[model samples]
Target: MDRTARILQDLYDSEINFTIATFWHAGFQIKLGLGDEVNGFDATGTADNLVDAVEWLRVQAIKKYPESVFATNYRR
Candidate 1:
């Protein structure tokens, strides 16, 4: 599967309850929705690979919504 699809599958498998899932190789942007809304990391970023992209999401989840229980089982 593609990057975005694969990522979404990971979220679904974990029951993350995210409504938004976007990733782009161009600057490696990522946007995720959870906990009823989104407030931070709502922009594009640069990632060297899938691993970096996943890490970015995790970090952003912590930064934007630290109280949330965000987890991604996707491995690069």
Candidate 2:
């Protein structure tokens, strides 16, 4: 799979909900939605590459779910 697909799979495996959009000249836009509607935290960021996008998502996930395994076991 491509890097972006791999990144998305990792997020799925980690039980993180996300959406990624690509723009011709603007790189990638990543949005991660965590938890339920009423108490959820949503994080959005733009990156020039998939790796950075996932890293940003990881940081946000950790911030919202400090006790989650995602904090320690997230893959690069």
The digit string of per-residue lDDT tens for model 2 on 1-76 reads: 9755665676678787876679888988877776544665477789997688877777777776666666566533
Q: What TM-score does candidate 1 reach?
A: 0.45
Q: CA lDDT, every prediction?
A: 0.52, 0.71
Per residue, candidate 1 scores C-alpha lDDT tens digits across 1-73 of: 9665665566555454443344554545455544444554343455766667666665654555554434323
lDDT leader: 2
lDDT score, candidate 2, position 31: 76
